[model samples]
Target: MSGREFDLVLYGATGFTGLRTCQYLARNYKQGVRWAIAGRSASKLEEVREKLVNIDPGLSTLSIIQADASSPESLEAMAARTKVVISTVGPFLKHGEPLVAACVKQGTHYVDSTGETPFVLDIIRKYHKEARDKNIILVPECGFDSVPSELGTKMVVDFLRKEYNLPTKSVKLSVTKLRGAVSGGTLASICEVMEGKEGGMKDTLDQNQLVPEDVASKVVPARITLPSVFYDHDFKAWQAFFIMSFANEKIVKRSHGLAVEADGVGYGPEFTYRESMSAPGFFTAALASLGMGLGGAALSVGPLRRFIQNRILPAPGTGPSDESITQGHFTVKIIGESSLPENVPADASADALKPIKAIATIQGGEPGYSETCRYLVEGALCLVQNEDRVRNENKITGGVLTPAYAFGHILIDRLRAQNVNLTVSKL
Candidate 1:
């Protein structure tokens, strides 16, 4: 804790994901990282540090910060010296509140690998005001759940505006393919969230963040059916809601509402975004959707819940190796449609209103934990590189944002440079 505090302090560094992040930092930390690992155990912190040294001898300079989530004081101390804190600890309802409170109180910028919608809603309601008051940014879901979806939306919408000259009406996101080993942390997150939380979590939902007390009170997640015009048309398949739809769409809407040119490619003015899973046919899509819907509905029963618990992801903390991650990749084929709004444009032909085909695909590292870690690590880099980000003495905050708004180009470049080549190409 000398001059320049540290660039980033990785909390929960002993966890599976946190260890991976430290591994990433160690490999790429060619210059002054001014970094340290923080967790409950000094012993585990030292052990992780040794592993880092083994992977990259240049990481010998890495340091440690022993902090307990149970103690607000330790958390505050750890936050005090870091410009940013990337936390991979979760099931947040159980182990997250104290550290979050410390970050808000310390005015340190915070990011987390959490997809727990209820937990995010809780934090937003409870701390958004305090964070705003302190002029800090508490960004959540900088992980696999929403990063691709959010950034993917930005890329597609921007392309439509640039190449097709049309405002977007709606954007759909889905997991095209995901196959990887699971970890205990992932399993724990699934169980805590699937089982639902005590309504006490809602105590943190911020009324003034988006709506007034009166308006926010009645606000609900309004649902809409798929466009009849979309099915059996341009799309080669059917899709359904992503489990983490709440976080991704909400943040996209927030960013769209704040941006001046949100109209051009449907940031918010004429368009909205939804999430889903890609399926080969409508029948398969409906079945998968039903299965997910039923899972949510049935988690409350003891027998069903217990049955799931028995099927823990092939052993917790088990993840793909370096060889696999280096080989894995993803591509998002965005089918962009450009059309003239119907207002009786006399000269407009049906083809003129028809969707002119355009596509964008993002190339990135292999999916699952390693790729998720890569995205997470790159997301932190994006945050650091954002022009919109305003840094002060011991603090850096940004205006309203999603990862794309804050760090899209940086992440793309970094990911590409890291060998996860991405491209915008013809379909």
Candidate 2:
């Protein structure tokens, strides 16, 4: 990888998130970080480069590579030139696999901001073994889809294990505050899922679907089913099903499964996880749940779906205004509880016998785009800067990995430095 032409390449650099990623790199460009922008249109790539130069004249020399998702040759060439690739292109089900294939073939690390669960499962099934054998990682859902949820869960689990010698029994995440607008790319992905394209929506319903078959077979399924709206005692807020919960939960579970497979222990043998968003009151929570349900149901209908995409949603490559992005923000709280330690006596008091708890929170700006770019860029940097630790110390032979599994505390440290706040404490 040291012989690669560039340290990183931002694929789909002309799209809304892609361009922001370029800007993020420009604003934070380190002296030795050699990077380039890549996409289908040379002109658009050039435009992005020019914008980057405007931010830091030092980026005037930033390179550009023209590659289209539709062309395998171009993708292969792009993969060959870079040690790592940050793909902002989606809906991943429609146009993501070829680039992933190219990266594995070239032994290049890869990351993407895809919330589509089926596509993730597809890639893991198809490429995990080969990528692992080659020692190159491929990570998806590095953005708002699952980073906060997945990594936040890790913070809680790690804290309990390190500080109290406890194995977690259950974890729940609540999006306590979210103020963000959707992007055309995100809407496109949602539309694909609702339409049952590729693997269909049913594939996402299985909680352990993303886990490897061998590990999943031995796993005990959690029996708790959250209602559409409920009151959460931990966060002390009315809760509703989070729009991204379906995707995030699976990613976190996959991380747990992979950890167990690698070391025979993960969060815990009976660890269960769930996610939801917070509302001010019970009525608001109910309305939010109803709205999400109705919106998903409507999108499943062909006529309604087309109308929404064509007439209502922003077109691909377009997104919220800069002001909107700056003003948007989100906060996720993760709570992990461990069962009583084996050493506890049967005569212990009721209070002493209670589960030990740890809480962690992830806070950042504009989840969909602004902070997401931070997550994506920082994730890539973590790979470039800590490749040895990831491969050797962590003993992680490359695979289709979740963010927590692939980068772990190195990524958490990077995000903290970038002001994507992550804090954990025992409760």
Candidate 3:
């Protein structure tokens, strides 16, 4: 690690999310954390550094490197120079593979803010074994798309294992509150998914791709239909479709699948996971459901998709005002239901057989922009500082991994220290 020129490198620093991530490093990491910012254009990278200088004058001396995703040699060079590389590049299905390949070749740890499930599944298929062999960690969705779902559920699963000595049968996550603004990068990623291209929305939504191929044929997720509002009496809130559901649900299930393959009792032999947004009331839930359904249907049509691309969504590099970013916040609640082993006595009382429920809440700053930056940078820092713990304690040395599977409690602890509220409780 000491031989590395930089502890970390911020790739795509010229993009909106990347620039904010640089500012975050400047503001938060003042204690000689050797880092650099890299992008396609040297001039643009310097411009971003100048902006960072405004945040911390000392950062004027920060190194700037020019690396383009299209140039495999440039990416390999960047990867070789750093211990970890954090990217805000997306729709990662297009520009992500080169950096990933370079990281594996260089044994550099990699993290990215990508919600594209197909990209993640493809990387797992192509590079998981190589990365494991090289002992280089590759993690994605460090941002809002599925961090809470992955880590929060892990919290619950771990808690159940410790307290009840039981495995989880079902876990449900609901977005109780989410307030954030989107950037052009986010919009572009969404558009690419809905664009009906080769690795587009339809293909990415396949849950079977999320798990290892050996398990993909065996594991079947407990499905929940979207755009149909329903009341979950446990939480006492109306539930509706969440836009990120297509990704998060699969990510959670993948975590379970990997855990099962690693150990006998994963989240559960019959582990099932689902997610939705909680509406204040039935009316609101219905409205949200209807709106999402209509929007999804419209995006599937060519004419409507063109109209959305031209008028409805922001261009790829734009973002919201600082005020909006600051004002943004989100909360997700995960409830894991536990069951006794099959060997339990048949004569057990109904109360004795009642399910044990473990609940966890993951709330933080805006899901998309400010908080996503926080999660990404903190995850990179975790990989840099606690790489040994992740490998030794979690027994996860390398692979294309979900955020929780990669960082686990090491990341949860880091986020809690940064004041991202997370807690587990009995319910």
Per-model TM-score on C-alpha atoms: 0.81, 0.97, 0.95
Ranking by TM-score: 2, 3, 1
Better of 2 and 3 by TM-score: 2
| Superposition error at 295 for model 2 (Å) | 0.3
> Per-residue CA lDDT of candidate 1, range 1-427, in tens?
1344876789988988889888878777666556778999999888998999987887776778899978889999989887678888876767887888888777677777886766776776688667766766676777776677666676666676777666655666555664455567776777777667333324113212332232332333334432121242434667754455555666655445434332232243445456556677777777777776676556656567667767734344555676766666665544444444556477887766665445555545555566677777777655444424434221334322345555555666777778864555323
- lDDT (CA) for every model shown? 0.63, 0.87, 0.85
| Clashes per candidate, residues 3 or more apart or on different chains | 9, 0, 0
| Candidate 3: stretches off by over 4 Å | 197-205, 221-225, 341-349
TM-score of 3: 0.95
Error of 3 at 36 (Å): 0.4
Report per-prediction Cα RMSD to one decimal.
Answer: 5.0, 1.6, 1.9
Q: What does candidate 3's lDDT look like per residue over 1-427, in tens digits?
A: 5699999999999998999898888889987679999999999998998999998998889998999988999999999999999999887877888999999999999999999876887788889999988878898888887788998899998898898888888889999999988888887787666774433344545654577766654566545444578999887899988888888888887887777667745678768887889999999998998898787777777777878988988888899988998898889999999876556688988867788899999888877888888889989988888888888888986888778887889999999888889999888
- Compare candidates 1 and 3 on TM-score and give the better one: 3
TM-score quality measure for candidate 2: 0.97
Q: How would you encode candidate 2's per-residue C-alpha lDDT over 279-369 as one tens digit per residue?
A: 9999999999989878877898888899999999989888899999999988889999986787778788887778899999889899988
Best candidate, TM-score? 2
